[model samples]
Target: MVENEKDLKDLETEQSALSEEETSEQHDAPSEKNESSELEEALGKIASLEAKAEEYETKLLRVQADFENYKRRARMDAEAAQKYRAQSLVSEILPALDNFERALKVEAADEQTKSLLQGMEMVHRQLVSALKAEGVEEIETVGKPFDPQFHQAVMQAEEEGYEPNTVIEEFQKGYKLKDRVIRPSMVKVSQ
Candidate 1:
Protein backbone atom coordinates (compact mmCIF):
# COMPACT_ATOMS: atom_id res chain seq x y z
CA MET A 1 0.00 0.00 0.00
CA VAL A 2 2.95 2.48 0.70
CA GLU A 3 4.45 1.81 -2.75
CA ASN A 4 1.15 2.64 -4.41
CA GLU A 5 0.97 6.01 -2.60
CA LYS A 6 4.57 6.84 -3.63
CA ASP A 7 3.78 6.13 -7.33
CA LEU A 8 0.62 8.29 -7.29
CA LYS A 9 2.59 11.25 -5.80
CA ASP A 10 5.28 10.98 -8.54
CA LEU A 11 2.64 10.94 -11.33
CA GLU A 12 0.93 14.06 -9.92
CA THR A 13 4.24 15.93 -9.81
CA GLU A 14 5.07 14.99 -13.43
CA GLN A 15 1.65 16.21 -14.64
CA SER A 16 2.14 19.58 -12.83
CA ALA A 17 5.56 20.08 -14.51
CA LEU A 18 4.09 19.34 -17.94
CA SER A 19 1.25 21.83 -17.38
CA GLU A 20 3.80 24.58 -16.42
CA GLU A 21 5.83 23.91 -19.56
CA GLU A 22 2.70 24.24 -21.74
CA THR A 23 1.80 27.56 -20.11
CA SER A 24 5.32 28.88 -20.77
CA GLU A 25 5.06 27.87 -24.45
CA GLN A 26 1.72 29.68 -24.78
CA HIS A 27 3.18 32.96 -23.31
CA ASP A 28 6.20 32.74 -25.66
CA ALA A 29 3.95 32.34 -28.73
CA PRO A 30 2.08 35.63 -27.95
CA SER A 31 5.42 37.48 -27.40
CA GLU A 32 6.72 36.19 -30.78
CA LYS A 33 3.50 37.35 -32.51
CA ASN A 34 3.82 40.85 -30.95
CA GLU A 35 7.43 41.12 -32.11
CA SER A 36 6.43 40.06 -35.64
CA SER A 37 3.68 42.75 -35.80
CA GLU A 38 6.12 45.43 -34.60
CA LEU A 39 8.65 44.40 -37.29
CA GLU A 40 5.96 44.61 -40.05
CA GLU A 41 4.86 48.12 -38.95
CA ALA A 42 8.48 49.38 -38.97
CA LEU A 43 9.07 47.91 -42.47
CA GLY A 44 5.92 49.65 -43.78
CA LYS A 45 7.07 53.05 -42.40
CA ILE A 46 10.51 52.62 -44.00
CA ALA A 47 8.97 51.81 -47.38
CA SER A 48 6.76 54.92 -47.23
CA LEU A 49 9.73 57.15 -46.38
CA GLU A 50 11.80 55.69 -49.25
CA ALA A 51 9.01 56.38 -51.75
CA LYS A 52 8.71 60.01 -50.58
CA ALA A 53 12.47 60.48 -50.86
CA GLU A 54 12.47 59.23 -54.49
CA GLU A 55 9.63 61.58 -55.40
CA TYR A 56 11.47 64.57 -53.95
CA GLU A 57 14.68 63.63 -55.81
CA THR A 58 12.84 63.47 -59.12
CA LYS A 59 11.31 66.92 -58.54
CA LEU A 60 14.72 68.36 -57.74
CA LEU A 61 16.20 67.00 -60.96
CA ARG A 62 13.39 68.45 -63.07
CA VAL A 63 13.80 71.88 -61.50
CA GLN A 64 17.54 71.79 -62.10
CA ALA A 65 17.06 70.89 -65.79
CA ASP A 66 14.53 73.68 -66.31
CA PHE A 67 16.86 76.23 -64.75
CA GLU A 68 19.74 75.15 -67.01
CA ASN A 69 17.60 75.47 -70.12
CA TYR A 70 16.47 78.94 -69.10
CA LYS A 71 20.07 80.00 -68.56
CA ARG A 72 21.09 78.71 -72.00
CA ARG A 73 18.25 80.55 -73.73
CA ALA A 74 19.10 83.79 -71.95
CA ARG A 75 22.74 83.51 -73.00
CA MET A 76 21.82 82.95 -76.65
CA ASP A 77 19.52 85.95 -76.66
CA ALA A 78 22.22 88.20 -75.21
CA GLU A 79 24.77 87.10 -77.83
CA ALA A 80 22.36 87.73 -80.71
CA ALA A 81 21.56 91.19 -79.37
CA GLN A 82 25.25 92.06 -79.23
CA LYS A 83 25.94 90.73 -82.74
CA TYR A 84 23.16 92.70 -84.50
CA ARG A 85 23.47 95.95 -82.53
CA ALA A 86 25.09 97.86 -85.44
CA GLN A 87 22.61 96.76 -88.12
CA SER A 88 20.29 99.81 -88.16
CA LEU A 89 22.99 102.50 -88.18
CA VAL A 90 24.87 100.73 -90.97
CA SER A 91 21.73 100.48 -93.06
CA GLU A 92 21.14 104.25 -92.81
CA ILE A 93 24.66 105.10 -94.11
CA LEU A 94 24.54 102.91 -97.25
CA PRO A 95 22.62 105.47 -99.45
CA ALA A 96 25.13 108.20 -98.53
CA LEU A 97 27.95 105.95 -99.69
CA ASP A 98 26.21 105.39 -103.04
CA ASN A 99 25.87 109.16 -103.56
CA PHE A 100 29.57 109.62 -102.78
CA GLU A 101 30.44 106.96 -105.34
CA ARG A 102 28.36 108.73 -107.99
CA ALA A 103 30.03 112.07 -107.22
CA LEU A 104 33.50 110.53 -107.69
CA LYS A 105 32.56 109.35 -111.20
CA VAL A 106 32.03 112.92 -112.57
CA GLU A 107 34.85 114.43 -114.74
CA ALA A 108 36.77 117.57 -113.58
CA ALA A 109 36.89 120.38 -116.24
CA ASP A 110 39.89 122.55 -115.08
CA GLU A 111 42.97 122.49 -112.80
CA GLN A 112 40.95 124.12 -109.97
CA THR A 113 38.17 121.56 -110.42
CA LYS A 114 40.77 118.78 -110.54
CA SER A 115 42.15 119.81 -107.13
CA LEU A 116 38.58 119.81 -105.75
CA LEU A 117 38.01 116.37 -107.26
CA GLN A 118 41.17 115.10 -105.60
CA GLY A 119 39.97 116.38 -102.23
CA MET A 120 36.57 114.74 -102.80
CA GLU A 121 38.36 111.51 -103.70
CA MET A 122 40.27 111.62 -100.43
CA VAL A 123 37.02 112.10 -98.49
CA HIS A 124 35.41 109.17 -100.30
CA ARG A 125 38.43 106.96 -99.52
CA GLN A 126 38.23 107.93 -95.83
CA LEU A 127 34.52 107.09 -95.79
CA VAL A 128 35.17 103.71 -97.36
CA SER A 129 37.90 103.00 -94.80
CA ALA A 130 35.58 103.89 -91.95
CA LEU A 131 32.87 101.61 -93.33
CA LYS A 132 35.36 98.78 -93.78
CA ALA A 133 36.44 99.12 -90.17
CA GLU A 134 32.81 98.66 -89.16
CA GLY A 135 32.59 95.27 -90.93
CA VAL A 136 31.28 96.56 -94.29
CA GLU A 137 32.34 94.84 -97.54
CA GLU A 138 31.60 95.40 -101.26
CA ILE A 139 29.93 92.56 -103.15
CA GLU A 140 31.68 91.49 -106.37
CA THR A 141 29.32 91.29 -109.35
CA VAL A 142 31.13 92.01 -112.67
CA GLY A 143 32.39 88.98 -114.68
CA LYS A 144 30.88 86.48 -112.24
CA PRO A 145 27.82 84.26 -112.50
CA PHE A 146 24.62 86.15 -111.60
CA ASP A 147 23.35 85.24 -108.14
CA PRO A 148 19.97 86.65 -107.12
CA GLN A 149 20.96 86.94 -103.48
CA PHE A 150 23.92 89.32 -103.96
CA HIS A 151 23.11 90.77 -107.44
CA GLN A 152 19.87 92.20 -108.81
CA ALA A 153 19.67 92.14 -112.65
CA VAL A 154 18.20 95.47 -113.85
CA MET A 155 18.73 94.76 -117.54
CA GLN A 156 19.82 91.90 -119.81
CA ALA A 157 22.55 92.47 -122.42
CA GLU A 158 24.10 90.47 -125.23
CA GLU A 159 27.89 90.42 -124.85
CA GLU A 160 30.19 88.24 -126.99
CA GLY A 161 32.94 87.45 -124.47
CA TYR A 162 30.60 86.60 -121.51
CA GLU A 163 28.62 83.38 -121.03
CA PRO A 164 24.82 83.41 -120.94
CA ASN A 165 23.37 84.47 -117.57
CA THR A 166 26.71 86.02 -116.61
CA VAL A 167 27.03 89.52 -115.06
CA ILE A 168 28.30 91.97 -117.74
CA GLU A 169 28.08 95.27 -115.84
CA GLU A 170 27.34 96.54 -112.37
CA PHE A 171 25.16 99.71 -112.41
CA GLN A 172 25.12 100.26 -108.64
CA LYS A 173 27.48 98.91 -105.99
CA GLY A 174 26.29 96.44 -103.37
CA TYR A 175 27.49 96.35 -99.78
CA LYS A 176 27.38 93.70 -97.07
CA LEU A 177 27.50 94.01 -93.32
CA LYS A 178 29.58 91.05 -92.29
CA ASP A 179 28.08 88.02 -94.11
CA ARG A 180 24.63 89.61 -94.52
CA VAL A 181 23.80 91.60 -97.69
CA ILE A 182 22.49 95.03 -96.67
CA ARG A 183 22.10 96.12 -100.31
CA PRO A 184 22.22 93.95 -103.43
CA SER A 185 24.37 95.00 -106.43
CA MET A 186 22.36 96.39 -109.36
CA VAL A 187 23.78 94.60 -112.41
CA LYS A 188 23.27 93.85 -116.10
CA VAL A 189 23.36 90.18 -117.09
CA SER A 190 24.42 88.82 -120.52
CA GLN A 191 21.91 86.62 -122.22
Candidate 2:
Protein backbone atom coordinates (compact mmCIF):
# COMPACT_ATOMS: atom_id res chain seq x y z
CA MET A 1 0.00 0.00 0.00
CA VAL A 2 2.87 2.41 0.75
CA GLU A 3 4.44 1.61 -2.62
CA ASN A 4 1.22 2.37 -4.46
CA GLU A 5 0.90 5.70 -2.58
CA LYS A 6 4.48 6.67 -3.50
CA ASP A 7 3.84 5.79 -7.20
CA LEU A 8 0.76 8.05 -7.23
CA LYS A 9 2.77 11.00 -5.79
CA ASP A 10 5.59 10.55 -8.39
CA LEU A 11 3.06 10.47 -11.26
CA GLU A 12 1.44 13.69 -10.03
CA THR A 13 4.85 15.44 -9.76
CA GLU A 14 5.81 14.38 -13.35
CA GLN A 15 2.45 15.66 -14.71
CA SER A 16 2.95 19.03 -12.99
CA ALA A 17 6.51 19.43 -14.44
CA LEU A 18 5.27 18.65 -17.98
CA SER A 19 2.44 21.20 -17.60
CA GLU A 20 4.94 23.93 -16.52
CA GLU A 21 7.19 23.19 -19.51
CA GLU A 22 4.17 23.41 -21.87
CA THR A 23 3.18 26.78 -20.38
CA SER A 24 6.70 28.18 -20.87
CA GLU A 25 6.74 26.86 -24.48
CA GLN A 26 3.37 28.53 -25.21
CA HIS A 27 4.62 31.94 -23.94
CA ASP A 28 7.89 31.80 -25.95
CA ALA A 29 6.11 30.76 -29.18
CA PRO A 30 3.66 33.66 -29.07
CA SER A 31 6.53 36.19 -28.54
CA GLU A 32 8.49 34.77 -31.49
CA LYS A 33 5.43 34.87 -33.73
CA ASN A 34 4.70 38.49 -32.80
CA GLU A 35 8.34 39.56 -33.39
CA SER A 36 8.36 37.89 -36.84
CA SER A 37 5.09 39.60 -37.84
CA GLU A 38 6.41 43.00 -36.74
CA LEU A 39 9.60 42.53 -38.79
CA GLU A 40 7.54 41.68 -41.89
CA GLU A 41 5.37 44.78 -41.48
CA ALA A 42 8.42 47.03 -41.07
CA LEU A 43 10.01 45.61 -44.26
CA GLY A 44 6.81 46.22 -46.26
CA LYS A 45 6.63 49.83 -45.12
CA ILE A 46 10.28 50.42 -46.03
CA ALA A 47 9.75 49.01 -49.54
CA SER A 48 6.79 51.29 -50.17
CA LEU A 49 8.71 54.35 -48.97
CA GLU A 50 11.65 53.47 -51.22
CA ALA A 51 9.34 53.18 -54.25
CA LYS A 52 7.83 56.60 -53.61
CA ALA A 53 11.28 58.14 -53.24
CA GLU A 54 12.31 56.78 -56.66
CA GLU A 55 9.19 58.19 -58.32
CA TYR A 56 9.82 61.63 -56.85
CA GLU A 57 13.40 61.59 -58.08
CA THR A 58 12.30 60.87 -61.68
CA LYS A 59 9.70 63.65 -61.63
CA LEU A 60 12.23 66.15 -60.30
CA LEU A 61 14.67 65.29 -63.11
CA ARG A 62 11.97 65.75 -65.80
CA VAL A 63 11.04 69.17 -64.45
CA GLN A 64 14.67 70.23 -64.44
CA ALA A 65 15.03 69.14 -68.08
CA ASP A 66 11.93 71.11 -69.12
CA PHE A 67 13.25 74.24 -67.44
CA GLU A 68 16.57 73.88 -69.25
CA ASN A 69 14.81 73.59 -72.65
CA TYR A 70 12.74 76.68 -71.99
CA LYS A 71 15.81 78.72 -71.11
CA ARG A 72 17.62 77.62 -74.27
CA ARG A 73 14.68 78.52 -76.54
CA ALA A 74 14.35 81.98 -75.00
CA ARG A 75 18.05 82.64 -75.50
CA MET A 76 17.86 81.66 -79.17
CA ASP A 77 14.85 83.94 -79.76
CA ALA A 78 16.63 86.94 -78.23
CA GLU A 79 19.70 86.42 -80.38
CA ALA A 80 17.57 86.13 -83.53
CA ALA A 81 15.70 89.35 -82.70
CA GLN A 82 18.93 91.29 -82.31
CA LYS A 83 20.35 89.90 -85.55
CA TYR A 84 17.30 90.72 -87.70
CA ARG A 85 16.33 94.05 -86.12
CA ALA A 86 17.30 96.12 -89.22
CA GLN A 87 15.32 94.00 -91.69
CA SER A 88 12.24 96.23 -91.95
CA LEU A 89 14.19 99.48 -92.34
CA VAL A 90 16.38 97.99 -95.07
CA SER A 91 13.44 96.52 -96.97
CA GLU A 92 11.74 99.95 -96.99
CA ILE A 93 14.87 101.59 -98.53
CA LEU A 94 15.12 99.11 -101.43
CA PRO A 95 12.60 101.02 -103.63
CA ALA A 96 14.53 104.30 -103.33
CA LEU A 97 17.75 102.58 -104.32
CA ASP A 98 16.08 100.97 -107.34
CA ASN A 99 14.83 104.41 -108.52
CA PHE A 100 18.34 105.85 -108.16
CA GLU A 101 19.71 103.07 -110.36
CA ARG A 102 17.09 103.86 -112.99
CA ALA A 103 18.13 107.56 -112.95
CA LEU A 104 21.79 106.65 -113.51
CA LYS A 105 20.88 104.49 -116.52
CA VAL A 106 18.80 107.32 -118.06
CA GLU A 107 21.34 110.15 -117.38
CA ALA A 108 24.36 108.34 -118.74
CA ALA A 109 27.37 110.49 -120.04
CA ASP A 110 26.43 113.62 -118.01
CA GLU A 111 29.29 114.69 -115.67
CA GLN A 112 26.98 115.99 -112.88
CA THR A 113 24.76 112.95 -113.13
CA LYS A 114 27.90 110.71 -113.06
CA SER A 115 29.06 112.21 -109.74
CA LEU A 116 25.53 111.89 -108.26
CA LEU A 117 25.30 108.31 -109.54
CA GLN A 118 28.62 107.39 -107.93
CA GLY A 119 27.46 108.73 -104.56
CA MET A 120 24.14 106.91 -104.81
CA GLU A 121 25.88 103.70 -105.78
CA MET A 122 28.22 103.97 -102.81
CA VAL A 123 25.29 104.54 -100.44
CA HIS A 124 23.40 101.59 -101.85
CA ARG A 125 26.46 99.35 -101.51
CA GLN A 126 26.87 100.45 -97.87
CA LEU A 127 23.23 99.72 -97.14
CA VAL A 128 23.48 96.25 -98.68
CA SER A 129 26.67 95.49 -96.75
CA ALA A 130 25.07 96.53 -93.47
CA LEU A 131 22.08 94.28 -94.18
CA LYS A 132 24.38 91.35 -95.02
CA ALA A 133 26.18 91.81 -91.70
CA GLU A 134 22.77 91.62 -90.00
CA GLY A 135 22.00 88.23 -91.66
CA VAL A 136 19.56 89.48 -94.35
CA GLU A 137 19.89 87.49 -97.59
CA GLU A 138 18.38 87.98 -101.08
CA ILE A 139 16.28 85.11 -102.40
CA GLU A 140 17.62 83.71 -105.69
CA THR A 141 14.69 82.54 -107.84
CA VAL A 142 15.78 83.38 -111.39
CA GLY A 143 15.98 80.42 -113.84
CA LYS A 144 15.29 77.92 -111.03
CA PRO A 145 12.36 75.69 -110.09
CA PHE A 146 9.40 77.61 -108.61
CA ASP A 147 8.51 76.84 -104.99
CA PRO A 148 5.31 78.31 -103.56
CA GLN A 149 6.83 78.50 -100.09
CA PHE A 150 9.80 80.62 -101.23
CA HIS A 151 8.43 82.03 -104.54
CA GLN A 152 5.05 83.53 -105.41
CA ALA A 153 4.08 82.63 -108.99
CA VAL A 154 2.83 85.78 -110.71
CA MET A 155 2.63 84.34 -114.24
CA GLN A 156 3.11 81.05 -116.07
CA ALA A 157 4.45 80.54 -119.57
CA GLU A 158 5.26 77.62 -121.89
CA GLU A 159 8.89 78.00 -122.96
CA GLU A 160 11.16 75.75 -125.03
CA GLY A 161 13.57 73.50 -123.12
CA TYR A 162 12.09 74.64 -119.74
CA GLU A 163 10.46 71.99 -117.55
CA PRO A 164 6.81 72.37 -116.54
CA ASN A 165 6.24 74.19 -113.19
CA THR A 166 9.69 75.78 -113.54
CA VAL A 167 10.21 79.50 -112.82
CA ILE A 168 9.87 81.39 -116.15
CA GLU A 169 10.40 84.86 -114.74
CA GLU A 170 10.50 86.88 -111.52
CA PHE A 171 8.56 90.20 -111.60
CA GLN A 172 9.44 91.33 -108.10
CA LYS A 173 12.45 90.32 -106.06
CA GLY A 174 12.10 88.51 -102.74
CA TYR A 175 14.27 88.68 -99.60
CA LYS A 176 14.84 86.45 -96.62
CA LEU A 177 16.01 87.58 -93.20
CA LYS A 178 17.00 84.08 -92.19
CA ASP A 179 15.74 80.51 -92.36
CA ARG A 180 12.20 81.93 -92.56
CA VAL A 181 11.00 83.19 -95.94
CA ILE A 182 9.80 86.74 -95.17
CA ARG A 183 8.46 87.39 -98.70
CA PRO A 184 7.75 84.87 -101.44
CA SER A 185 9.23 85.66 -104.85
CA MET A 186 6.90 87.11 -107.51
CA VAL A 187 7.69 84.68 -110.32
CA LYS A 188 6.31 83.29 -113.60
CA VAL A 189 6.16 79.53 -113.53
CA SER A 190 6.51 77.53 -116.77
CA GLN A 191 3.54 75.40 -117.70
Best by lDDT: 1
**Which regions in candidate 1 have their CA more than 4 angstroms from the true location?**
1-48
lDDT of 1 by residue, 1-191 (tens): 35445644765675576567547644643343577786776676568557656755765575576667767988999987776667788889888888888888878889998999899999988988888887788999989999999999999989999999999999998988888898899999999
Local distance difference test, each candidate: 0.80, 0.72
Query: Model 2: how far is 168 from its true place, Å?
Result: 2.7
Model 1 lDDT, full chain set? 0.80
TM-score of every model?
Answer: 0.69, 0.57
RMSD of each: 25.6, 24.3
Error of 2 at 69 (Å): 4.5
TM-score for candidate 1, please give it: 0.69
Error of 1 at 183 (Å): 1.6
Candidate 2 C-alpha lDDT tens digits along 4-65: 45654765675576567547644643344577786776676568557656755764575576
